[model samples]
Target: MKLKRTMAILMAGVTCAGALAGCGGSGSKDTGSAASNSGGLTELTFVMASRDEFMSSIEEAMVAEAEPLGYKIVSQDAQNDSSKQIQYIETAVNGGAEAVICLPVDADGTQSLIDAVGEKNLVFVNRPPTNYSELAADNVTYVGSNEDTSGYYQGEYLANYFKQKGQKEVKYLMIQGTLGQVSTTKRSEGVIKALKDNGINPVEASAPVVADYDRPTAQEMIQPLLTSGKEFDCIIANNDAMALGAIEACKDAGVEINFPIVGIDCTADGAKAVQDGDMAMTVFQNPVGQGKGAVIAADNMINGKKLGTGMEELGALDTSGKDYSDSIFWIPFEPVTKDNVADYM
Candidate 1:
């Protein structure tokens, strides 16, 4: 496959410089061959949607895992542009990459990416496409925790807290991530479903604010709500960053945080907040596990190994009892509270 890709590029008179020039403003860091490195080292291109605290951790883990296995990783930042992501994948494929690991900018718009990589192994990380059925090829797979599970954990924690308090109904302020992403929608829906399943009536204290998974944006958006004299029993953020932002907003407004505040992605800050008695709980979405799993999946595919091969290190794979288990690798999410925050830290 590598030889054929190389010959195709050469015969088409396509140089690395020309391909990269077409990538236009997309930030990239190449640690392997520029465009012509077809040496003994296998090349894998990692195209990220954007860089954030959790995403950076995943990227670092991928780099660490790849180095010891003699795989060269070319990391690129798509800056949340679908077109840029497609360009990066094309450039990587034309540059003789054995596999393309991408965190799609727009999960719903991944058909273009699948078409771009053609026969090369493509591993979609962190965010899976909206349509799971679209990933029909054996060469394509998804590696990430179930977003619904993460939110379910959050809702379960909150439900237990309220139930122990003997409260039947709770009003919550929700800080959502990017509006259209599968993570945002599923996380939001899952939390609601869990709350209902737990026999808790949930009410929206205020209209949910979209923060785009940004901390400062979450803080700014929630500040007015804090001072608006509205009654909310708790705050629920799609991710830890936004949860921390809500905490900041509460502090800035001199509001006492007597209610539970929960979030997903037991990030360092979120765990610290849980320990400090600020955040009631958080769900741990293992970035390191996801990253390593993605790299291993790519290596397995390239070597003609079955999917999920060598992924036992990530614990038992959650096949969801589906026939397509081979194409989806699920990393479990753990609920982190004061009792178990130390374990995650």
Candidate 2:
């Protein structure tokens, strides 16, 4: 009982404890990575990617998974700004955080932030980094799903759905997430590539996408496309939010697109939409699994725990791809069709 509790507390983010008390001596780049703050619970910091519903799921899961182990998790919302995210790291370092978990707003721009951790402890979620070396660095781990897998699943589903129905071509309106975000880029790439791989040449009905993974924004963005009189076989959104928005747009325009509209992040609403036949399907990007996996990895690393064989079964992503390593943990993604959507809801 005591052992389990200690493990939990160690990954706790920020609290009223002795975080500012002692251990003021900074070591490697990850200065406080393995140290305890004076007279307080271990301090950990979580830098949120944004405050959207999807991001909220990550935070809620982190708290649910980490708090019971006896840690107070402090969250810093970057509000889609990379500069502000760096500021959050400075705050964590000065506040004496033992470890920092971040869902980066800018994956390519996180090198400075990674440097800022100074070896204290760094775990990155959501965005998959282009720099593979960072994940293998000492005191650094990348905890996220395979960047292209979710998109691949979405594209694969569409291709198979149409192929099974004996359809030849697919005309899709791509409602993307944040334009430059790794999630957006990879998800879009995965879908496009997967479609091509499956012998499906997808046609884009809408050009100059309306980005930013917001429902209203997506709804608004699709309005122009609806009025353009272009035929669309389906909609592909980087997230469920945009997909839901597209649905709303169609309803308001009285445009019925009776096709398989696919999305990622089988969010609660997305799953419900599938049940009601509002959308065809979505992929389950496990926020709960990613959140808890981060805490567990941090706990084990701090205690000098080596990852054992068959660790790949944990199911976010397997360790066989480019990002595969002991330091990098991949969370697997699952496709949620109507036949299995109820299991998610």
Candidate 3:
């Protein structure tokens, strides 16, 4: 009787513990329960800063990638406006989006997003927000390319071209992106450093002429550069949109593009220009990969899987931790000149 009583007591203890665990699992306060839902069938909203053709391509690609996985990707284009971006974020949150993928035009524009998401995840693509270290909490990852490295390559390519031609000095026109943006600043710095290294001191032309990544603005800006009678050895634009505009301006001025021009974002038009020898080269930022990576990271976050290989985890996408220093998801960048444009096209 004593032995049977002891066995009965042990079984009773195990049963009680299992019952307690079941109750805890059903409670809304369970953290593990929340983490497990992170990878489920989630509704994600991708808010881009503009409605340009590049972003359209990203949207199309993202739709194709998300459909098979049973996820919905709703896009909100802010048209380069900060207030509009904030509104879109609010809308996404209100609509119960599980995650948000943003391309903030201004670094500090998305602070409210962090507040709204709370435990939900947010992935900043293309541009990481400012002061992200303290802002990014448990569920956030940035997926994009290294702007400085790509810029360095752009600079090196332009510098080498100048040197190969044996030009004593090159007077270049720089059409930069918005001031204070990390992407714009880093790229311009790289180009400037490369030009100096090549025995060429470049004149910092107008304040990037404020093209706003629009072809019309770039075209208008370039017309003045051509009409001003200022001789420029090359027109180095921060993006292919501006470069295309410069090409149009060159055509209107009846000035043949003799100097080698350099640009970033090897879009379809950029590749065509390179093939025609109207533009020198472009650094291709793989938009397809950028979109796919963001979706994959969000899915992993939902699944409770760590953001990296077995040994690592990525922090917030902003310039914060040593974790993202080796983010393997970074897409590759390549210089596409006339030689390589044919293959890429």
- lDDT by residue (42-160, candidate 3, tens digit) is 56789898877667766776776676766778788887888777788777766666567888867775676666566666777777766545222446556666676666777788778
Pairs in steric clash, model 1: none
* lDDT top scorer: 1
Mark the 10 consecutive residues where model 1 has the least summed lDDT. 4-13
Candidate 3 error regions (>4 Å): 1-41, 132-136, 205-208, 309-329
Q: Model 2: per-residue lDDT, tens digit, 1-345?
A: 112111211111112122221112111132424334553556567898688777787777777766665566788999878889988988887776767888887778778778887756777876756676555455676666777688999989998988987876788889988777778888999998888899898888767475588899999988888888898888899999999998999899998768777889988899999999999989988777677777665555455454212233443233243423545556667888999886786
- The true-versus-predicted C-alpha distance at residue 182 of model 2, in Å, is 1.6
**Candidate number with greatest TM-score:** 1
Query: How much is the lDDT of residue 328 in candidate 3?
Result: 26
Task: Give the distance in Å from residue 152's predicted Cα in candidate 2 to where it truly belongs.
Answer: 1.1
At residue 26, what lDDT does model 2 achieve?
18
Q: Write the per-residue lDDT of candidate 1 for residues 309-334, one digit (tens) a residue.
A: 67765464342454244566777778
Per-candidate TM vs. native?
Answer: 0.88, 0.85, 0.80
